[model samples]
Target chain A: MAKILVVDDSNFQRNQILRAIKDDGYEIFTAENGKIGFDLFEEHSPDCILTDLNMPELDGLGLLKLIREKNTDVPVIVLSSDTQELTAEKCKNLGATDFMNKPFKKDQLKAVLEKVFQ
Target chain B: MILTPDQEDAIKEFINIGAGHAAGALSELTESHVKLSIPAIKVVKLADLEKEDDSFTKEISSSVRINFKGFTDGTAALVFPPASALKLVSLVSDEEFGTPDMDSVQAGILTEIGNIILNHILGAIGNIFQQHLEYNVANYVEGEIIKLIEPDDSTPDLVIMIIDTQFNLKDLEITGDVVIFFKLGSLTKFVEAVENVLS
Candidate 1:
């Protein structure tokens, strides 16, 4: 089972994604903010990371940097509601595996993961 | 860094662009032909919050806040008084209703407004300043404005740029405010950007 780390400040958003993929048999670990998300990532070493862009203490970009320090190839997907191309571009330059806008469909997640695994 | 006269004018003009664009966007979204415009903008400490602002913040029942990070980082919040909140939801959703309340359903409806308003406002800022800021999902809460945007203990006092806007939705004279709280050092950076653009 592939393990996924989910990081976001909003519980509603976190639950929405988790519900979408919980039955896929992927083990999921969740964190409220980037600081704890990074700690959980270090502890769990999830196969991939799904994170929100903005948070207190440390943001998703900061967490992405921390992840890339030790593991360069982990698929980090940013799930954001912000439609700013600049933010998506920033994620790509920072080595993110994918960027999915909010209110995404189940098929969208599945497709991204399939590509990531392939 | 204290703002020079040129810096102040530039910032004001920058906000004018952002707010004007946002108002147009709002009109398009609601299909109500509403004219939303900012009548005044100010830089103030929380201690000096205007009386109407103080009362409005206290009376408002719902708010959506988005955090942004760039040359400056802070939260931009659009808080609506209960009457105005109800009006906004009805207008945006095109649902006829009376006595609006913040249930799970209505909150979802208002979140749409928040997303559009905040994103367009930020988009305008990003376009003008040539700064790409990372913004988060709108954090929605039902409470007083101050309680919802609780100050972290580390930064108890806030330096805010308040954009006081008049949103004339049909006959209802509702007001919404975009309160931007810039982080410690970012205020200086933002002013410098304004000065640079003017120069």
Candidate 2:
């Protein structure tokens, strides 16, 4: 199983993603915010990273930039509930592998993960 | 800025119905009983929001805030104490809680849950008003307090609803607010709609 890192400020959101991926048998790691997420990224070097866009401390965009600066190849997905089109486009420009809107469906998440892992 | 008595009553009724829909959505998703209470609804000037010293974060061990916009110009925040959030994760994942990565997974789940509940509530509002409303995808954030205000330089009156409730799955207590900011023109329509409904 590939190792995965999930980062978001909310414990509830992080847990939901963890539960979805755990059945896949992947080694999972989590962080509460961008700063912690960045720290864990260095610690685990996970196969994939899923993060929220708006967070206290450091936001997803900032974390993505930091991760990109360190390593460009790892898949990073931007997950957010923000409806503004500009934000989604900005995430892509920043080198995010993909983007998913909040309140994502189980199948939708699984599909994205499968694509990333593939 | 003035709402007739009938208009106020209609707005309250509409919000209550929307809250019920949100509770139902949560129940279906978690397969648990959801209890929601509508404590009050207030319309405040954007400037006045700063005066309300509400600390949902201090009361809860940990909290999650998700925001959605588009169909309605507002934010729907879901705040869960740390213990409550963890318990929810455990129930959904069916994994013994040993601190499995908190950032990615929990944020994802909370984002989705927030999206569903917010959508349900907003969708209910749309239905009541006979208007089609679409929402931006939901996202998760953490803080002591999460507020949705009109952008700087834009002064718009907003309707704020405080909802206190608990989810049956592990008895997680969630308290949050749904904020809707109406444009000057839409405000008129809203008042008219409320009047029509109540009349």
Candidate 3:
């Protein structure tokens, strides 16, 4: 089973993502912000990470850079409401595996996870 | 409202950046081309919102409202006339609905859209200005603007920055207003940020 870490500031958005993937059998760790998320990444060494871009303390880009320092192979998918092509490009340049815009469908998220795990 | 002409222009430039990014997010979500027209912004008392725009105050509308406070304190809302809200939800869900009334499911979808768009706009402002903001959960409400956005009791004379944003998606044009009602004291801080950016 793949261990996945999910990080976001909004409880509602986190719950929505959890509800979408709860039945998928992935062992999940959750954090409310990127700092806690990076700490969880260090402890659990999850196979993949899904994170929101804007957060207090530490942001998604910051977390991605932190994760890359420790492990470059683990897939880090960035979820953001920022639709700027430059944002996606910046994530790519920073080693993010994928970028999905927020308000994404459940199936869309699930499919992306499936592709990542496969 | 005490801003100089240069300061006001700077504020509008910030708002346009935020709205442009939000429009891009909407376009991606709906898989359509979305263009944002230059936003028309005005400052008015909360009581005078009806006098400012008929589409927002007079028509039946659906809105998602979020309250946030940090470097600046205020309420922000994405207001859509009923038909436009219904059309947008339909476009997202690939469903056909004859009525302008949105069901729970449709409202949920609209709330999500609003959350994304509003977040993008606010997030841009926060990032560009380096302000830390904490947001209340997004709320979906329907009906008149007065009912949707209640005036703050503590600040009886709340000033509102009404940003009229028009989203042009493919052939259909949808109009929504991003209304940010700044608390009395906080407006100064926001203006200061604008001036700081200028200097």
Best by TM-score: 3
Instruction: Give lDDT tens digits, candidate 3, residues B51-137.
Output: 764577687789998787888998889999888888888876667997767888788778778888888888778877876676665
Candidate 3: true contacts recovered, fraction: 0.16
- Every candidate's DockQ is 0.16, 0.09, 0.17
What tier of docking accuracy does candidate 1 attain? incorrect
- lDDT score of residue B47 within candidate 3: 63
Runs in model 3 lying further than 4 Å from the true structure: A1-118, B150-155
Give one digit per residue, the lDDT tens place, for model 1 in B18-94.
66666665675566667777776778655555454455555756778877787778888887876788778787667
lDDT tens per residue, model 2, B54-143? 555234334333344333444556666656666665655555567733667666765666665665565566667665554444555555
* Predicted structure 2, TM vs. truth: 0.52
Best by lDDT: 3
**Chain B TM-score (each prediction, in order):** 0.87, 0.71, 0.93
lDDT of 3 by residue, A1-118 (tens): 8999999876656876898899999999999889999999999999999999867688899999998887568999998775555577779999999999886778999999999988
* Ten-residue region with minimum lDDT total, candidate 3 chain B: B147-156
Sorted on lDDT, best first, the list reads 3, 1, 2
Superposed Cα deviation of residue A51, candidate 1 (Å):
14
> What lDDT tens digits, residue by residue, belong to model 1 across residues A1-118?
8999999876656776787888888899999889999999879889989998767678899999998988568899998655566778889999998998654667788788778767
